[model samples]
Target: MNRPHYILQPVSPLFITLSLTGAFMLNLLPWGRWIGAPDFVALVLVFWGIHQPRKVGIGIAFFMGLMMDVHDSTLLGENALAYTMLSYLAIMIHRRVLWFPVMTQAVHVFPLLVFTQAIQVLVRFIVSGRFPGWLHFIESFVAIALWPAITWLLLAPQRRAVDRDHTRPI
Candidate 1:
C-alpha cells in the first residue's frame, strides 16, 4: 500500500500519549458479564487503524497487547496475536470502512470486535480447553454502543490538528 504523508504530518505529542493511556485505562476498566461489550483495545485499534493507520498499526497493537499480557498474566502470545490480527484487518478494510456513517460503522464494528474476540476465544479453547462464558460478549456490545462517542472524543482534536498544521506555515 502507498503510504500517506503521515510522518511528515507531525501528529501531536499530547494526542499520542493520551490515546495510548486511554487505551490502557479502558482495558483496565472493571466490568462483569452482565452486558455484552467489545474489547476496548480492539475498539481503539480500529479507531486508529481507520483514522491513523500509519501511526497505530500492527506494531502498536502487538506492543499494547504485550503490555496487557504482562499486566493480566494470560498467555503472552494470546492477546498479542489477537490484537495484531485485528489491527491488520482494520487497516485492510480501512479505506472501505471510512465511507460509512458513524452509526453504520458501529454496526460493522460490532462484528469486527466479535471476530477479534472469537480469535481470542479460539486460542484459549485450544490452549486451555475453555473460554470465557457468555458474559464476555458484553465487551463487544459496549464497544459498539460507545463507538460514536469514542470516535468523536478521539477525533475531536482533529480540527485543532489543522490549526496546529497551519500555525507553523508549512
Candidate 2:
C-alpha cells in the first residue's frame, strides 16, 4: 500500500517549543533510571534537528543537554557535548535522512542515538571508572522503535489536511 504524500505547512515556532518542553517534562519523570527507559529529549531533539534544522539546531540541542545535565546531576558538560554532537550530525545529514521512508529514517537515526548514549557512557566511565552495562544501550533501540509514532505526532501540526475544502482559502 502506498502512503499519501503530504505538503506540510510551515511549522510554528510555538509548537516546536511546546514539543521540546513536553519532551523535557517526560524526561523528568521518575522512570528515567530504568534499564531501557527511552530518552524523550533525545528523540525530540533528533526529530526537530532532522525536520527543522534551521530553527532547532546545535545551539538548542546544547541548551537542552545542559538542562538534562543539571537534572541528572552528572558532569556539567556531558549531555551538552553529546547532544551538541548529535544535533551537528543530524543537521549534517538532515536532507539525506528526509528523503527516506519513516522506517528507513529510524534506521538512520539509530546510530545517532547510539552515538549519543555512547558519548554519555564514555564520559561517565572516564569520570567514575565504571560501566553501566550493555543494557544502557537499550534506550536507543527503544527510541528507534518510537520513531514512526513520534514522526507522526510531531508532524501532525504541520501536515496539510488530506481533504481540502475548495471554498476556503488557507
lDDT of each: 0.77, 0.95
Q: Each candidate's TM vs. the true structure?
A: 0.81, 0.94
Q: Best candidate per TM-score, number?
A: 2
lDDT of 1: 0.77
Taking the candidates one at a time, how many backbone clashes does each contain? 11, 0
Task: Please state the error at residue 75 of candidate 1 in Å.
Answer: 0.5
> How close to the true structure is residue 37 of candidate 1, measured as C-alpha lDDT?
37
lDDT by residue (tens digit), candidate 2, 1-170: 47767778889999999999999999999999898999999999999999999999999999999999999999999999999999999999999999999999999999999999999999999999999999999999999999999999999888776577989555
Compared with the true structure, what per-residue lDDT tens digits does model 1 show for residues 112-148? 7888888888988998998788777678877888999
- The model with the greatest lDDT is 2
Clashing pairs in 2: none
Q: What C-alpha RMSD separates each model from the true structure?
A: 5.7, 2.4
